[model samples]
Target: MSRISHLFSGTALAICLPATAALADLTAEEVWADWQSYMSSAGYAVTASEVVGSGSVAVSDMTLTMEMDDASGGGAFEVVLETINFVEQGDGTVAIELPASTTMNMSFQPETGENVTVAVDFDQTAPNMVAAGDPGDLTYTYAAEAARMALQGVTIDGITVGPQIAKLDVTMTDLAQVVKTTVGTLRSVSQDMTIASVDYDLAFNDPESDDSFQMKGAMQGLKLDGTGKLPIASDVQNLNAMLNDGFQAAVTFTTTGGNYDLSFSSETDGSGTANATSTGAAFDVSIGPDGLLYDVSQTGVDMNMLLTELPLPLSFSAAEIGTRFLMPLQKSTEEQDFGIAVTLNEFSMSDVIWSLFDPTSQLPRDPATLVVDLSGKAKVLFDFLDPAQAAVLDQADTVPGELNAVTINKIELDAVGARLTGSGDFVFDNTDLATFDGVPRPEGAVDLTMVGANGLIDKLVGMSLLPEDQAMGARMMMGLFAVPGEGEDTLNSKIEVNDQGHVLANGQRIR
Candidate 1:
């Protein structure tokens, strides 16, 4: 006897074996029914026009619909699948396929105006889904060959605004998920997708003008990978509840290398061209109980552009650009902390572009850099994602929170022959906005040090980049606020805002 059979004995085997076998021997119809039930539980209305066969079932003209109501307007979305096929294998598995195209339509009804409709058409080549294992612990895999998609139509307030896409090709190699029936949850899911190429041409007539505008562009080699965990019970009906209860996800997108050439033309204003190339780019994002975090970085970015009616083209390049953001999760009316940083490294402009402003090339040709790091705390006034809360926020005149404190851990700028570095910590007095002309009053001092400013100004004056009168005015302003530093051609300054509404620079009252 098989080991599985050996685990059971005569009468006990007869009783429990059949039950276990029934759970393991899931049919195509059962799988489809379960999907329908699950979607319905998640607030979607699912329907199918025809369901044929038993073990190997084929469904036709299936649709899923969802509706959302908001203060600004209400919206409804419907997705239609032309056909789907499911074939049961003898090895306790079923193979599913979407053999035809899919279409989605969204309509929004504004509170005081007409409705708007947006439609999309998607194409695929029998993308497959394979399911296996027992009912309580099933696994499903999804994969697809290269496919195309395009925007079909768009209409707003009964006015047709045509939208189109010439071509978009996508391919997916790995996608999988595990479903746990006992807890009614998806244990985990992971996916990786690649966009092989994209070519597009779009045109729209100006509503107020007789002239029309058009744009054309192309790109290649974009990739995306993602993984997620849904700790909440999948059977939960409320979508917001699922997110609030337990949800964690992470996704990363990157470009393997690509070039894009975009051209824009207007019937009345001539035309322009822009070309860009990059070696690689990446963006990563995550969300969990700790809150949201994201990082974006790109390298080898080079661009050349000519604006309409411009005399010359502009060119620039950067070795790398990056930024990061973090916000702690706040589930209640409590204070939350956040951090942000930005970087611009090894950035430079072509001489042809720089000569327009600096004819003598007085500025240094070395690459420039700018970096900033900041962190702060604030009390969230409402649920940021809730439509009602958003409506309230939009109606308010100012942001609905008191900024407890802000710290500028680092601030650095390097360009031309000048370098500036500064750091500061500040506290805001939200109620004293009137003292700062409707802006939150800040009470603190920022210490700054600058190098090479005097030399840069002298060079600029010698190159005639700055008029003598303007240069004198600039020096006078600096003398009034900044004090001489220990180093040659260097200066130091302390900008302070006191509780008595006084603005001072280097111990001298300025305001």
Candidate 2:
């Protein structure tokens, strides 16, 4: 119902905290006040019926509502809790007791569409939660033997939808979390959480058509940590304003392993079934004074698909997959830093897939890999998240930023019995953008090395995969740019873009 609950449940954050053995005397009223203050600071409208009793405060019909808006439109969420109890635990701590079950309603009204509302039921079994520490600096610890969230129902503009329309259920086992909040000019919150396992199943059916979809998945050993410094007076929905006012947050989530199965049916696409599994996965994101950063990775991933149109099932696997990017969010007069990196390690396709083209198996079934790393400096000319600026950029031909420099830190590709590696650094001259056809003229050089290129080409010709004429043309192109290396079957090339805007391969000028 609260941000705390949301954080500990789906979006997790938890960290170890010091022992909270009774120190200073605490009251239930103080704990309630802190809870309300924390929620209010997070931009939630809080309301409830409070009754005071001996050493406890009973809150009934408590509700927390949040509304979010962006350039297009917005939606709202309402959490209604039947009852909660803040009981003083004699030992300077407060026992926060929640009902066994609750309901959260999410409503959406788009720019053009009927209004819709979806309700989710939340439940916890044998839950234990408590809060302690000073008024402004509080620590909350929570644990539950098991927890579950299931879709209760859906409605269109207050009219209930049929029960068969949609269904979703998720169960979590062995949940534990620790959260610490310090309120001042900035509402600083940090937390850590761990979950032994999570299982989910979802299905959706369109009454108007044969379109339907179903998915089921399970994940194990999830651990996450997060921290945020939110501006006290800024609206949580206004990310641009918050960033300008010194707001920042970061979160890292990881899972030991997971698997999923999905099936879909449609009049146009017919029917299909698919399944995927992974040994582990990780996701990390951060936003701060500098900019935004995002990274995701997975290891030991395999997927199989069967479709009505396909004669045989298609399957593929990868030893590792990952991508990362960092960029500036706010406009700046001077250049800002940015970077992007990608990796696909040991990727392989099933023989059933390869046999479609190379029935004789002329080429090796070795796994392929691709790695790239690019970093650059650019000037953000306008606010990326500002609605007005966004509208202007959409209508204008001018870009929102200007690239100044790029560094190709690394590049590697190994596949089809060939390997290639390269690196480069370039500086763009914005003043001379005309020479490269509106692209800024660059002054830099790139060094590339290739191994087994000729051998792969010969194999392709023998397999009738590449026509003889086409193979000759490819070799001609490679000869124009590359020179024979010291090792047999190796080629090395140096491509450069001079300050005068001339393109050259080795010492030969091509343009």
TM-score of every candidate? 0.76, 0.94
Off by over 4 Å in 1: 1-30, 41-43, 50-53, 70-72, 100-121, 133-138, 151-221, 227-250, 267-270, 285-295, 322-332, 339-341, 389-399, 429-443, 484-487, 496-511
Q: Which ten-residue region of model 1 has the weakest summed lDDT?
A: 9-18
Give every collision pair in model 1: none
1-511 in candidate 2: lDDT tens per residue?
3333433332221111222654576788987887777667667778899999999999887667767464435555555666778898878898888767877665566555577777778888888888888787888888888889999898987788765878999999998888888889888988888999999999999988989999999999999899988776777666688898888889999999999999999999889999999999999999986889999999999999999988999999999999999999999898899999999999999999999999998888899999999999999998967777888998998777888999999999999889999999999998997999989899999999999999999999999889999999999999999999878799999999999999999989999
Which consecutive 10 residues in model 2 have the weakest lDDT in total? Answer: 10-19
Per-candidate local distance difference test? 0.66, 0.84
- Each candidate: RMSD: 9.5, 2.8
Please give the lDDT score for candidate 1: 0.66
User: Candidate 2's error at 17, in angstroms?
Assistant: 12
